[model samples]
Target chain A: MEESNWEPKVIGFLCHWCSYAGADLSGSARLEYPHNIRIIRIPCSGRVDPMFILRALQNGVDGVLVSGCHPGDCHYQSGNFHARRKFAVINRLLKYVGIEPERVQFSWVAASEGPKMAQVIGEFVEGVRKVGPNRLFKDEKKDGE
Target chain B: MENRLKEEAGKLLKEGKVDYIVGYGKGTVNLRTSPLITNKEEDLEGLVINPFIANNLSRYPVELKGRVGIVVKGCDSRSLTSLMQDKKVKREDLIIFGVPCEGVVDLKKLAGQIGAEIDRVTDAEKEGENLTLQVDGSKKTIPFRDVIFDKCYGCEHPTPLEYDMLLGSEVAPNLDIEKSLERIKELEGMDAQERWNYWKEQFSKCIRCYGCRNVCPACFCERCFVDVNMPQWVATYATWQDNLTFQLIRTLHVAGRCSDCGECERACPVGIPLRSLQRKMVEEVKDLFGHEVGIDKDAPPVFSHYEATDPDEFMK
Candidate 1:
């Protein structure tokens, strides 16, 4: 638990049509990105409920990233568009409740954007690292044990 | 006003226009009222309209099965409008008896000022800007402004905005949206850590009573996420994290649908300042989506519809 060795635990929810493919492309291209993220493949960004992000944070993830297809490029036509609206409300709500806005990030990564996907992940990990661990939702009793 | 309310209820009952009228009856304790649903003309005598009538009758209509008549204040009417907009209640099934409100008093504040536990409030009367309360055979005069709930101070609708029949003369709304905005701005000025600590301390006091959610008119879901066990969305425990998660989820769920009736805050046993959380979303829905809930029946909810030009400054 030394400060210099500390690495944030991040959860990345990648939509199947675009962000998932972009992540796959990153792996195939062997691009270097932060190893902290644990990816959860979802059908589409619209399927990612705000509860999922909250649950992840409550269970002690340091950060969460929801990556979807570009708004117009959604595989389900307007799924990403709907998700964009939902995420906007959710983001503002989290910030209003005093949670760090940087901890929960949203992005649009196309199926062809391998380098961009890697860069987004790298940047998010670094941002979360600077904020240190998410102590807001951590259970102190469990931590002590 | 009480006689007029009883007369209306009697007429509606005798005419067979409504299955039952939802109104307020004297609570077992003084200075309190309870929801009373009655179909009999004789029961109409129990229907009362006083400054102590704090229960929102709008919540009863949704669970009712036939044509129903209900008495509503300005805030209750807004909640009814939201229910209609959400398709939870049908206008054709409702016969609204609107009452102009001069704001309701917070009994706690009144009791605190008196410096004694009130065994019984024998009589209560409001004249002009003062309320004379006969508590335990002793009369005490308190300014109406001093005893009124905080929600009523800047009440934007003293008269029902939408009603089938008006029971009294309309009163002008005391606009308080600016005051709400100022408080939000003050909170925004605090650093993230300070804000987080503030909420953490506030949420830690929650007892998991769920009174806030139960009393809210907007929380009409058949299966609330917290009750869903197949994939449990939130812990049922009263830990700060669980309480915070439950509150955040509930607030987001009611973002565009909340009428700011202050029922949740009023019902909260812990006095968690629930309205602050709700008003934040209310303010944001207005600023970011250009939408206000329960104002127009035709308009879709703020989140249900979005313009392509909606702000996306946070997205990468």
Candidate 2:
């Protein structure tokens, strides 16, 4: 895999009240994970529109992770539940299109799960590395390479 | 055709009752007549009714300014009825010239049938029952039932269910309804996991163009869920899961209000069978409330009126 010469670019969308705080705890605890991930904080995981995921793929992101509160622990009470249903539907669609489902990940992360957050990110980064960069929609007709 | 409708339109336009008249006119494009909007009397000469016209002109009334006179066919009038049902347009807003349409032809299907490309076409003659179509180069006569849209084939009513001015002789309503509901029945009968898998396969290919919503007459919300920013329903990704969420939510919102116009299915560039999904909801509405949209202008929308005896099949 080292000789494959592929670096994965992962985009993480973490809900503000849960996953984002868990991520902050991971940094505070000095936990180490792959540094290839770029995090975008959102109000709630439910706020992540499906278009955001497609746009990232179109812009050449290798993998996308959407982390929110656990099923029953969403700050807004039922936001995570809605997000779960949405992710299930979107995940099934990607599988149908022959896109490796591993490229998209959904996880439940509460504010206290610092070590778990680091572990999740590390596992996602490793999985993405094995899968390699997503060149599925990358522009091949660049005027100057 | 109704002489009263022409007289009313002519009187309204002559009296400056409307800024323009929007109706079906001669096809300038290949084998397809479009919704023609006119401010001049000369343009009204092109108006003819036999039933090759197939456009929902309801959207123009919402967008265009000033008073407008519109010709409403059976399905086209349904669009108007839906708009009125939703309070989107008022009866006094414009003059309506209703045409009793047997059914409109599906131009896309007709184009495939005839090898020769059609530059322009119209339903020129109706000899007893058969409709004669004059295309760019040649004239082909086809049985009215054979060439019209499938939705129209099973049409329970040939006259505009609601219209201000009746233009043509009203044809007896053809009550063959379930022919269109067959596919919906097949899908609804499938087990949950099977249905899920089937839909997963279908929604995965969707590009999320919003064409289905845009073309639907019932979906008149100024700001759709796709544009909502407060708590976005789905991500802006083309991924299968996101597309599923978008469609499921949108479909649920339009459950009872949809008239099964088939515009969503036609507008789909990738040719997804959206009508099947829509038909399922239509069945549910009928089963629950015995309510069919656009059929009766007096009945309140299903969602707007709650029933104490509503089914709780999906409720936990």
User: Considering every candidate listed, which one attains the maximal TM-score?
Assistant: 1
lDDT of 2: 0.72
True contacts kept of 1: 0.67
Give the per-residue lDDT of model 2 (tens digit) for A1-145. Answer: 3436667889999999998999999999999878889999999988986667766775678899889987668788777666664565455444433456668888888899999999999998888888776755433455123
Q: Candidate 1 — which residues are off by over 4 angstroms?
A: A141-145, B118-120, B176-186
* Residue-level lDDT for A83 in candidate 1: 83
Interface quality of candidate 2 as DockQ: 0.04
Question: Which 10-residue window in model 1 chain B sums to the lowest lDDT?
Answer: B174-183
How many backbone clashes are present in model 2?
23
What is the C-alpha lDDT profile of model 1 across A13-123, one tens digit per residue? Answer: 999999989989999999988999999999999998899999999888999999999867888888887888789889998998888988999999999999999999999
